[model samples]
Target chain A: MKTAIDIENVSFAYNEQPVIRNVSMTIESGDFLGLIGPNGSGKTTLLKIMLGLQLPDSGSVELFGTPANEFAEGTRLGYVSQHSTDADSMMRVTVREVVEMGRYPHAGLRRLTDKDHQIIDDALKTVEIEEYADRRISNLSGGQRQRAYIARALASEADLLALDEPTVGVDADVVDQFYELLTELNAEGITIVLIEHDIAKVSEYAETMACLDGELYEHSATSEFLKSGALERAFSSARAVSSRSVTRGD
Target chain B: MATETTRQRRELGAVALGIPLVLLAFIVFVVWVFPPLFELFWNGMEQLFNEHWLVSSSFLQHGFTAGVLIGFTAPVVGSYLVNRQMALIGEALAHTAFGGVAIGLFVGASIPVLNYPLLWALVVAAIAALGMQYIAVNTDGYADIPIAIMLTGGFAVGIAVISYGVVFSATVESYLFGDILFVPFENVQLMVGLTLLVGLVVGLTHKQLKFITFDREAARLARINVWLYDTLLIVLTALVVVAAMQILGAILVAGMLVIPVAAAMQVTNSFNRGMLISIVFGQIAVIGGILSSYYLGIATGPMIILVAIGIYLLAIVR
Candidate 1:
């Protein structure tokens, strides 16, 4: 099987405080990876490293057999970050324009072609936001705005979607719809790597789970994570409570 | 989405905001600066006009050109800087250019080989602009701290040169507070070229710039070079700041960059519309300020800024 990501003994720090400590992990192609940890356990930092936004202090990351630093084909991967909605309100472009920005990487000194426009419209329809295509993004609801960002990522036509807390500030009812949309996209076979603080929540969608507590245990399946005491040893009290909440009906 | 009626109303509001500039310019030119001089030079100008047809006084020509170009260019770039919430950087770079002006003056006095104050200002201001970004990135200081440091550091150097008596221009007080009296035709040509370059580059990269400003991290994720665009935006800002100093002056160019864009935002619904409206407001400020300065014998920079403020107040009310 082709490996989608290969991280080797990576460690990182900020202002002399260590974050990711000698963590190694591999995510195979087509695997939905759920990276979960405590609030300060550096899940977002790790995600940033995987996407080449920030370089790790030591060790290396290989994306699709190319080193993260040398990976020239960034359009092959899509990313949605936290606070994306906040930036949306400051800009005055329409939702369609916002989604079309995803084509910039491929457009490359030329205007969008018919195929690019078709892809953008398709992405918006996939996210069910074709209604607000002409409307400014500032007018959209939080969930709808997030969908716009997803449409932006989707418009890139990437094979891998790496989202950092996509549902952090969104309301609960919308979050279910958001996750359902993700599942639908996953059903279409795009690989997903989602970062979350709660293992229980992400375990619902992720087949493979990595519990990071300054270090990584990447090979645990969701079923083993629930049955084994491995999570109790690696996580803080918050995860323990969330773990109980997830296992209650089971 | 704004309906057609609302859009028409918004455009009307922008034009209305622009009306006072016309009145102020009319009062300044017809009432004050040109009364005695217009009488003395009217026949000479008319005869020259008959021969050359475009014959105008260097002052009027330079002032008119500077006012219009600054009007068109300042707010286009200013809108991006304002939307990014980096308005202070504009102020800082102007001071850097001011220091450059001082350096140019001093060098011309001591060396006599080099003498263009405006060109020197551009060079130093560009360096200072890039330096501020460098300081902000390489150091642990706050973002605004680098700006604050550059702001005062550049001005402190300028003040020191003035105090040393090496760079003070006693006759050209207009250089201190902005005046059209001393602007040579050659300098107007420079402003014209600079305006064209700034306008062209900005027009080409506007969409990419919009993306970078909207969400830098997302832009980076999508393979946009965030650092390159950020540097480009700041460097372009430095160029505009240098270009605007002829009318708004160094002490007051920030007003041109910020106020017009602020006022325009109140009247328009979208980014591109707001930017277009901002250029209109900026033109009003410049034309009105130049006219008033010529007639009333007031400082042009302050006059322009005050007009912009009044327009801003009116925009808020509407």
Candidate 2:
């Protein structure tokens, strides 16, 4: 299997205190990788470093074999941020317009061609939100908005998808649906790197798991992870009990 | 759009209705008590709407052409500013242009070689915009910090120059509120060129500008230079504001940049359509204001803005 992401001995600091210290992890291609931790556990920071949105104080990130800083193939990697709506809602734009923005990186020499439209429509169909394509984005529900974002990621036609707390403001039921959609996409041969705080949801869909608490605790198969109690060190006792119960049920 | 309701159409009608009422008021005022202050175009009043084509007088020709050019460019660029919530940038640069006006007047009085205050206003406004962008980058203040600083600083320098009466007092009012009728052919030619430049730049970069305004981070991620687009937008605004100051007045310049977009926003659901509506509304405001001020003896700047305010009121009721 190809190595999709290689994060090496990375440490980042805010002011003086370290937020991410000596953390390293690797994601193999075709793996559904879930990264879970407590609040401020540097999960988002790690994702940012990989996407070149943030630089680590030490060590490095390699995306699909190229150094993150020198990686010029950004179009081959799809990213969905948490604050996607905040800046976008300022303009009066439709869902189709937002999804079309994904093609901008690859829109060379010509405007959106017939092939591009087919892909965009397929992305919408994949997310099952095709009916809302012409509606203004601000008019959609939270789940619908996430579906639109996922469609944008799909439209990029990248093999790897990186999500940063994508289910942040979603309800419990909606989160289940979101994870199920991720599982379906993962089964369809896309490598997914999901940064989530919901341990229950992450355990249900992630084939491989990494526990982080400002430091890497373990990276192993989900079955091996569940056999051990690595989450105990990362989460509080109450959360550990509920998360264990949720994972055991899965 | 099919979604455009009857209420919206009626609200737009309210806006259209204001122009004729204003025109009637001017007509009654002209017939009631003829003011010699407008002895410039009192004759051939019957051709007031289409009189610019007649070229009946040089003043009317210059005034009408300048006003129409300003009408189009202000909203073309203003739509982006309003969407980005940077409408105050226009107000800031207009005041900064006043400082340029003061410098030109003083220098012209001393040297008698540099006599165009509007040209100086353009230079100062452009530099001030770039300088403010620089300060915004180096300072810890918010995005609007430079605009706020330039606004007060520019006005202070302009007011001080005039108060000192250092060759800036006698000709200050024309620059302050605009003297569109008295514009030289050279300045009118410059306005034409500036207006065309604004139109061309905006037309060429419309999608990129919209992308930056909509999502700067995403645009950056897509390899679009957000900084370059931001600078281009601000510089274009500087050009538009300086050209408009002499026709729209420095104090009222923000009105042209904001109110028409606001009115358009109330009616249109998309940014492109909103911009188109804004340009049309700006034309009505400028043209109607010019005709009213000519007939009723009022400052063209205030007259245009008052008509804009009436349009805003009509939009608000929707």
Candidate 3:
């Protein structure tokens, strides 16, 4: 199988404070990899690096064989950030307009054609938000807004989808539906890299799982990962360190 | 269902009216397909008004033409800036342009050939815009810090230049407090050219600009060259500021960029529709202010801004 993302000894620091240290992993094409960790495990930063949104302080990243810094095919990648739903509340944009942004990378400088419109419609339909297409994005519920973002990804025809805590503010039932949609898309041969705080929930949908606590603890199939106690080790290790700091403070 | 049908019909009506006008604007401004379109428009206005002095006089003609073009270009560019919460950038650029004008006047006192203050304003404003963009991107402080610095720093420079050179206070005051009667025919033509450049640039890069305005991180992820587009937008704002400074003055110029879009946003949910409506509102303000200023014998700059504020209040009330 072709590799979707290849990270080799990637290390990143914020103001000389290392956040990601000697972390390395490879995501194969069509893999639904759920990356779970405690808060500030550098999961989001790693995702951004993989998507070429940031540069690593050391080592390298490759997206589909090209160096991450040099990778320019934006059309093949779709990113739904953690703050996506809440960031543009003041913007007066319709759902269809938000979805149409997916096609922007495809139709640079030229007007959207009939085929582009058709793809956008298909994307909206896929997310089942065609009914709300004309409505203002700000007026939509959190669940509906996420669907709009997913539809945008669909419209872009992106083979790889990267989401950072995409269901943070969503309701419980809506989160399940959102993951089911991810599952369906993954089955349709799209590669998904998702960072979710809910470990059990992500493990249920993800075929592969990776745990990170400043560094990679484990990367394996979800079933094996659950049995291997890597999640517990990663979490307990962080807890141990925090408790040690507390004891020292006393 | 009835409301839905009405909304659809209204949308269709807007599209129908919009397409022709957009095509006309592109042809007239971008391609210069019909250089006589303005003459035809003025002649029609003169004939309709029975050869009134306001419509027949060449000074008023040039002033009105310049006003209408500023009305068109300012709000279109302002839509992006306002939505991005960078509305004050216009104010900053205008102040920098004022500085440039002061320098131009000082230099022109010695050299007759380099007397075009607007030309100098364009150069200084564009450079300051790029400098502002660089600082905003590279620094890690409050976004408004650079804006405040530019705003005050540019004004200080202008004041220093004016005081040192002993430039004519009357000539400087016209630019500071905009005189509609001061616009020349060549400036009107320059307005047309600026309008064309703005229209073409916005038309081509609307998607990129819209995407960046709504979400900077996503635009970067899309490899849309967020820095380049941000720079492009700031430069465009500078160009519009220089073009608009002739009629709106340094103080009120940002009003032409902010107020119309603010009012339009109050009424519409779609950015594209809001942009179109803002242009409509801008035209109304320009025309209303010019006519009111003519009759009331008030300053056209403040008159236009007050008209725009009135529209905003009305939109809010609605």
What's the true lDDT of residue B155 in model 2? 91
Model 1 / residue B289 / CA error / Å: 3.0
Weakest lDDT window of 10 consecutive positions for candidate 3 chain A: A241-250
Fnat of candidates, each listed: 0.38, 0.20, 0.56
lDDT of each: 0.77, 0.78, 0.88
Q: Given candidate 3, what's the lDDT at residue B240? A: 98
RMSD of 1: 10.5
- Per-residue lDDT tens digits for candidate 1, residues A1-250, read 6888899999998766777789888888788888776666678888888877788999999889988866666667888876654456765667888888888766654457999999999999999999998888888887888899889888988888998888877887888788889888887878889987656678888888887766875457788776766567666544655544231100
| DockQ for candidate 2 | 0.17
Number of the predicted model whose DockQ against the real structure is largest: 3
Q: Say which prediction, candidate 2 or candidate 3, comes out ahead on DockQ.
A: 3
Chain A TM-score per candidate? Answer: 0.90, 0.90, 0.95
Clashing pairs in 3: none
Interface RMSD of each: 12.2, 13.1, 12.1
Full ranking by lDDT: 3, 2, 1
List of clashing residue pairs for candidate 2: none
